[model samples]
Target: MPQRLELAPPAFNRRKILIHTAAAGALAAGVGVPRWARAQSGPMRIVVGYPPGGGTDRAARLVADRLQQLLKRTVIVENRVGAGGRLAAQQLVNTPPDQTVLLLANPAVMSVSPLIYKDLKYDVQKDYVPVAAVTDYDFGVAVGSALPVKEVQHMLAWIRANPTKANAGVPGTGSLPHFFSLMLSYMAQVNIEVVGYRGSAPLITDLIGGQIPLAFDTLDSLLPQHEGGKLRILATSGLKRSPFSPTVPTFKEQGLPLSAVGWNTFFAPSTTPRATVELLSKAVFQIMSEPETRAKFTAAKMVPVAMTQAQTEASFKAFNTQWTPVIRRSGFKPES
Candidate 1:
């Protein structure tokens, strides 16, 4: 896995502030700044924290396609997969700020990585700037259809009854899946063991193979299997029933309203220009609003959402505060 992006303080705006003190002063600067300087000149690489074949990767590809068209430049997605997505986050923050690289930015790196690693090389708040982000479906908790369990209560009963055989698989130890599964254990009042995999792909594989009978992961990963009759969804981790599966129950329906939607977002290096971020964000939202894009994401059990850079940043801030107490109590601490 790539390391998390190291945080560098935002460049002081004093210079730009002074230069744009008045409309005439701003006009002088605006006229002098070349169109080429304002426009992105090269290919834009959309980096993902995980490898291809999963939700983040697939969504990145979707956004990449639209970005390429909208920007009139090549848009590429590269998977940096590792260290709970810290690798990709770190890579983006370290890249030059020429609007050349962006991240498919997973919570594993942005929200959770800061809570887990002792020395997370990057500071999500300071080192990376949101470009655009999607609030995809929440992680779903399910069991093999072969299991007798049907709901959260039943699953808890089954786990408690067959303590030896009951276990759940998550994407990675400190990733969002792991955090949610851990929360499930707390809610269920049982010590269901959590097993981590390289990514959602292998985790789903083991799930179907029955190497693991229970698991909690992104709906993007479990949708195909669940819909195909490979696994039975016990409870979706999201607060509401996903539009993709009206029949599937949510943790909230079962009376656990604490669960909320998860997200996969994109961000640029901290040094990247604000204008570039706005352009990228606009392109992403435009793509997400398209029926084809929404349909495709719905099919994958991942919802298509697009938020402006400021909106994305605000959302992340709220999520950070929302989960802080819960995570801190779990004995996890942010990197110093």
Candidate 2:
């Protein structure tokens, strides 16, 4: 079991008062403050692994805004983009456990990358503590105007018929979309090739320009075009239809027997105090439960679901168990 930090009500109240008093005095004196002291006085940071404007970054900013209001402390989002989010994960591992630094991480940084990368810098299970799961999203299998098929069945048939044009677009190599597409090919018994792009925006741009026939990306990334009639989403990688797009069917509904749900979760250094983890987790749960917050996430085609700390850890482990073998069997190796 994870360690739990408990404090007496009276002692906690007294400590809070003392800390605030000391912080005020320190500011008045204008003396140089230590990092640990500044942690208690400075604005907290929520690190994002992707560039601004992406779903992950947007989600982090949303939570940061709310968390600042709830905690009565300034919270900022810092983007440490690169290495498919591994850079941010590594930074979090090296960060001090002062309750001021947190990370909004994707499953790839926590579960998939460790299994695939030969020299992963950190062990997620050891270096980080799961605070709360913010939101969940499913990938959508979409087609450009260049493709004749309008649905998953038709798309599969088309792929089988035109083996030479069986290329599928993904955000990047070794990404969840890549693995999910490979799983689809394995189960559907087709020879669909994957064409990886640096990110989803370029892939979607090419798809719209008829440069790519098929692409798989977060529902949020493709929903606008799908709704605008510029693209057709055949199926989503969810157990059920997405709330944002109820008319769209899931892969399971289309007889694909696959469900790949990705989530953005909050994490702190593993050495963080248990009390701090519990406090932040409670705040996150409250933030996610807000009707306005839920609406915003749904607008972005993400489902707002908050899990307890224990539940979050279990979910992480379950995802690792489910995907590690599938990724290994796919026999994909990243370029060194």
Report lDDT per candidate: 0.68, 0.77
- In the range 128-216, model 2's lDDT, one tens digit per residue, is 99888887778889999899686788998999889998889999988888887876776677787899999888999999899999998
TM-score of each candidate? 0.76, 0.82
Q: After superposition, how far is residue 219 of candidate 2 from its true place, in Å?
A: 1.5
* Clashing residue pairs in candidate 1 (N, C-alpha, C atoms within 3 angstroms): 1-82, 1-83, 2-86, 2-87, 3-86, 3-87, 4-90, 5-90, 5-122, 6-122
Query: Could you say which candidate leads in lDDT?
Result: 2
- For candidate 1, what is the total of clashing residue pairs? 10
Clashing pairs in 2: none
Tell me model 2's lDDT, rounded to 2 decimals. 0.77
